[model samples]
Target: MPATAYDAKGLLKSAIRGDDPVIYYEHKRLYRWIKEDLPEEDFTVPIGRAAMRKEGSDITVVSYGLMYHRSLEAVSALEKEGISAELIDMRTLSPWDREIIFESVRKTSRVVLVQESSKTGGVMAEVSAAITEEMFDYLDAPVTRVCGLDVPAIPFAPPMEHFFLPNADKIARTVKKVLEY
Candidate 1:
């Protein structure tokens, strides 16, 4: 499960109680950078459901993990510029919330998928393909992706890493590009 700080407690508890094996990922950078309040009582977030971060009509932005936060930044900027971009946070990859995603696509008719991984064989590839296959007629433009460069591995240097990974600016640019179509 790719969980946010707010969903950490609930997702962790859900993972522990589930029957199937699960791999929970926690971004080290997020530990100190993000904070959220949790319910006082125990709770669980369904493993297959996604969270809708924002709603809009112009376009849809789908992302996960750290990229989800970056996408939020891009969405906020686009809002300031009078572009309304709906944002979806895919909490789980294997069984992503296709209903929510497809619903957003039906409304916006355009989408940009963001990921920190390379463009090739990344999660976005499968997602884009699914959208094309299942919601092709609903689309007004081709699905776009804002992902890391196709280098074998991201560089360690801060400047190189920033250039290689998908950031807020990159995501916003891609979103705007898709919106134009």
Candidate 2:
């Protein structure tokens, strides 16, 4: 199974203890993240469960790994404009928590998926398709994706890399567009 983890501690522990073989993809950017709120005793986040980062009524934003960090920034900025975005960090991709994702979509009626991969194909596409397929009736607007540029590879130069990858402004803009629909 292919799994992803945003939290430095909780999800890592869960993956280590799971019986199934897992290909865990650790985001390099998240390696330095320090979580000060962990429990005093050992704990583990369930393998198939996603952690809800924030709750809102206007829209749902789904992402994982480093993209989750970027989406959080965009969601916070949107909040200042009075657009509420519910954020979900998909802790595991293969066995993603559909119940949480579907419930959020049902309440918000709109969703914006973000990923660091190119716009052509990725986990974002799969999740977006699943939402449309299973919760089509609940949606007020079509599911939207805010992903990286469709380039062969990310640019080596720092400046171009900024443009190639999914960032906060891009995500915020896409969320606003979906909200306007």
Candidate 3:
């Protein structure tokens, strides 16, 4: 069997065992299947925590994994438009940074969650639910999420991948829309 086939089997096995929350990051690069890069040796990356990337009073953008990088790019674009967006990168999802999100939402009263997964039953839904449950009273505008369309995996083509995935420009537009709301 090929390596790709073997990897597919391993993923299925892991999912069945439910040993760990498998982080399935899709490849954006067309015509390639890239594996996640872990440290060369066994090392510790503190999970279930968050890092503050920016400080601002206007609005906060919270995301994890790929969306974290996309959110940063969106914030950079927002800055060019005179809207300083504070970004919080949630390194882990299960034990997300509720304190950071809550405080930021309370202070700014506005938030936009940027994610790469499909919106339906995706991470963005959980984030929106958390904010509304915990900080609804503090919100000035409704919480919003910018996520990919609920479509199947992209084809091994550059144009197809670009169309299927959420890009920085799309994220920036979403943030701007939320700010206007």
- Candidate 1 similarity to native, TM-score: 0.97
1 against 2, candidate with superior TM-score? 1
lDDT value, residue 60 of candidate 1? 92
lDDT of 1 by residue, 1-181 (tens): 4648767777778889999998887777677887787678767888888899999999999998888999999999999999999999998888889999999999999999988889999989999999999999999999999999999876999999888988999889988888877
Candidate 2 residues lying further than 4 Å off, grouped into runs, are 1-6, 33-37
**Which pairs clash (backbone N, Cα, C closer than 3 Å) in model 3?**
none
Sliding window of 10 residues with minimal summed lDDT for model 3 = 1-10
- TM-scores of the candidates are 0.97, 0.92, 0.74
Residues 19-53, candidate 3: write the lDDT tens digits: 56655443243115435543354333344446677
> Candidates' lDDT values, in order?
0.89, 0.84, 0.72
Winning model by lDDT? 1
Candidate 1: C-alpha RMSD after superposition: 1.0
lDDT (Cα, tens digit) per residue for candidate 2, span 35-134: 4555687867777788898999999999988888888899999999999899998878888899999999999999999889887878888899999999
Name the lDDT value of residue 127 in candidate 2: 92
The C-alpha stretches of model 3 lying farther than 4 A from their native spots are 1-45
Top of the candidates by TM-score: 1
